[model samples]
Target: MGAGIAAAGLSAVNWEKMLQIAASWIISPVLGGIIAAGFLWFIKVKIIYRDNKITAAKTWVPVLVGIMGGVFTSYLVLKGFKTLIKLNFSTALSVGFVAGVAIWLVMIPIVRGQAKGLENRNKSLKKLFSIPLIASAALLSFAHGANDVANAVGPLAAIVQATKSGDYGSAVTIPLWVMVIGAAGISFGLFLFGPKLIRVVGSQITKLNPMRAYCVALSAAVTVIVASWLGLPVSSTHIAVGAVFGVPKLIRVVGSQITKLNPMRAYCVALSAAVTVIVASWLGLPVSSTHIAVGAVFGVGFFREWDAVRRARRQRSEIVAPLAMPKEERRRRKLVRRSHVMTILAAWIITVPAAALLSAAIFWIIQLSMR
Candidate 1:
């Protein structure tokens, strides 16, 4: 009689808890998206328009692709991992981390070459635009922090519920530390390794005016925010990359230098990255947004001779100055490059597992301590 009574109580508690978990899963992303969208809109109308610039036409195309792509990729990947591994959160986290590292190693060289080629082709923008770029980067970072952090925290919330109620359906307040760690890890990834990818996005995939880049960034942020508000999981990386490509295409369509535009190459890269994410997720590997974005940029860069053509147009004197560097300085530069490569590799390898391990360990310890 006592056992029957206890089981009935447990079931009742679990049912109530499920409602809470469902509510949270629905609300959190919406809140995150609202915040992202509001900030992006503010930047667009107040800052971007103040400069008398407009985003390229058909900008929505890439923004839509990114939103759809991110949502689809994330859903499929998460679902596949659960189906294949049947592992606990801890094991899955570690596995995902290893997979992310592997993807990074393969992507870096390709992205670097693309960045260099893009730089070679485009005349560097005047320094005046630096402030706008920095601001845009901050906006990108904020959107990333809001959305991606949710990805890290979502499982933790589930684990906490499982531990506390001995059920999977409870909702618990997310701790400050978890938020801090996720934000920090993402910031570290952006600050230390983001510049390379940024250069690729900013310079390599397409030459963007500050106004154009701002529009692209604004469009991506806005789209993500809207999706998030609707509880949609979207890819900020895809949106940003798409925005970058969209501008060049727009310029071409209006009978501007269409010959220089390479929509086929851009589309190919984007498709490959999407396919890669799907494959990786299916294999239960957690891939990085950074990696996918970088790979896409690299793919577009490798198939063209635009760089060689651009180099031919520059003054010969400018090319010779870099070669005149002192041997020691050149050696130092090489060392810096190698170190950057290694650091990026380490971050990629460690992120998923580290987050998972941290989450699991925290949950386990809390359970023990509470008991």
Candidate 2:
């Protein structure tokens, strides 16, 4: 579409914006995975792995609910209802914090009530997550509609603007009716054809308990909000799929296989990466340094193991063994299906160029027919 428009002298392509979007396509999923894994780990350590699970849930679930409430409140104020009202980030954050505290106070008794009859088991814990998970899912759906509907109607809006004014600028005000149509079309299409895809994503690829589903839903919502704040275009599907893949197993693989990370080491990596990026930016360099952080992790892991072996050899002593899981057990414990991952990756790779080519072809045909 950009190609056709440029060829016809309709609009100049903003390659920089395109680059930002392409970068987002990569970053959003990784960010979602990181956030989801981090949140899930916190839940496990604070609540799931506790001796008194009911007690822990009663204590922590309200806090988690409050956090989610705050995020959603801030997001709505900042972006969701931007058309109806305007607010700055600081004000939005302030509102969110106050709302969050109120929610925390309200949920305390609710959580306690829910925990009254529950057993100290993971199954019983699922009940605690049910309400939050549903709310998160609803928030994710709203975010998805807000973000992806623009993708659907954006080109049509541009064409309408160009046809009316013959000035296809980078920005155009989308008509209200156009938005309604886009949203309605999305809902209608999903109602007709969404179930098969949902089945594949929901159950075929990986089985999701309420806990895992909550993480996936919240991660996707939070990722979309963050991406919107940064003016990046991201796919909700990608973020959700990435969150689904960001289970405890991935953390185990990274910590056990690539590197063993204590809290201090993890903090070091995060801080060093931030410092490096700040320095690079100060020096007037544009850099994406996620790979740099990853390299540091692997480098630290290898160096430590080598140093341990060297000291062991010099002292004629045994080196401490790394944690190990049996291969069969590991296979059985795997949460992600490799086949689905490969299929999804293949679709992602093919979809972009194919869609662009098809759009270009259709545009040319339309032009020819009009001529």
Candidate 3:
């Protein structure tokens, strides 16, 4: 899309295509929110709030395996390598099956852990989810670097080609170094600008335990898969923030939070984010990973708060004397920090127009200078 836009001015860019992209900006986040919230509801009713969390947790383990395997496998098959690993539809399915089996194997011990010496045994078993969450984040990060690297290098490559060929339409070879520059840019961004934003996403929205984090990450992947199927033009980042979670928050691509993720959280978030990105690319919506990621965290935060409210109501009804609860405990859960969410939303809204205006100013300067 950047290459096309660079080769041709805005008039040359298809308005219909632009409209589709615009529609996705709205639809992507909404869709992502719905999917994520629905999944959380399922978890609460079936696992967290269920009478048999042990069995429920065990049951969901295999289902999550299928989800992760299928999502990642589809991602690899669709995107693994334009020039490297290739998997046809059937082959991809096979790989997914194998991954599912492997995940199940790993999950067994965690699910089957001895219930002895443990209070809230089901809660304890949930910790095993952190392992995959970390692994997924790593994969997401790698893919993000790969996909976004192209974004960084694309204009450079196009410019180089145009300069050499003296024609936007001419075929030209892309230098590998261009890609390296993009990757370097991402690494630099992470190293330099990541810390401040990581804190915002990690803790500000909600109290994210590993389980919630996993849901956020996994939902991002699932939404991308869904967007692909529906042929929607959603932003990569919107799906991420709406679909993904605090994992993206950790990597500095999404929201701000204080501490960095442990190795596991980092891994899962990055991998899931990358997969979400590739899926978005395949769908032709090269939306901002940062925006999507932030939205996803917000969605999770919002959902958590809603869930808390619902739980409170339920508990209140069951309690003989609801008024006996402490004042602090009686306070409504602030699942999401409204100020941060507003700030992030405002930034996303302004980004494109801000860039356009800046570009126009630069163009005006150039015209005066050339005169």
Candidate 2 — worst ten consecutive residues by lDDT sum? 275-284
lDDT, model 1, position 108: 44
**Global fold similarity of model 1 (TM-score):** 0.35
Cα lDDT, all candidates? 0.37, 0.54, 0.54
Model 3: residues >4 Å from true position, as ranges? 1-13, 52-55, 82-87, 110-118, 121-126, 170-173, 222-279, 285-287, 318-331
Point out where model 1 deviates above 4 Å: 1-130, 170-172, 235-371
User: Judged by lDDT against the true structure, how good is candidate 1?
Assistant: 0.37
Model 2 global lDDT (CA atoms, 0 to 1): 0.54
Alpha-carbon RMSD of each model: 18.9, 9.8, 5.8
TM-scores for every candidate against the unseen true structure: 0.35, 0.73, 0.75
- Greater-lDDT candidate between 1 and 2: 2
Q: Per-residue lDDT for 1-371 in model 1, tens only?
A: 12222334344334453353334322322332232233233333443334322221112222323332343334323443555745654454455455545544543443333334232211222122333333433433444454556665666666666776777543466777777877787677567545554444444343334433433343333333333333433332322322433433322221112112122222222333333333323332223333433333332332223333334335444655433445664343321123323333354344434544554566567668988
Model 3 has a clash total of: 39
Q: Kindly report the root-mean-square deviation of model 2 from the true structure over all alpha carbons.
A: 9.8
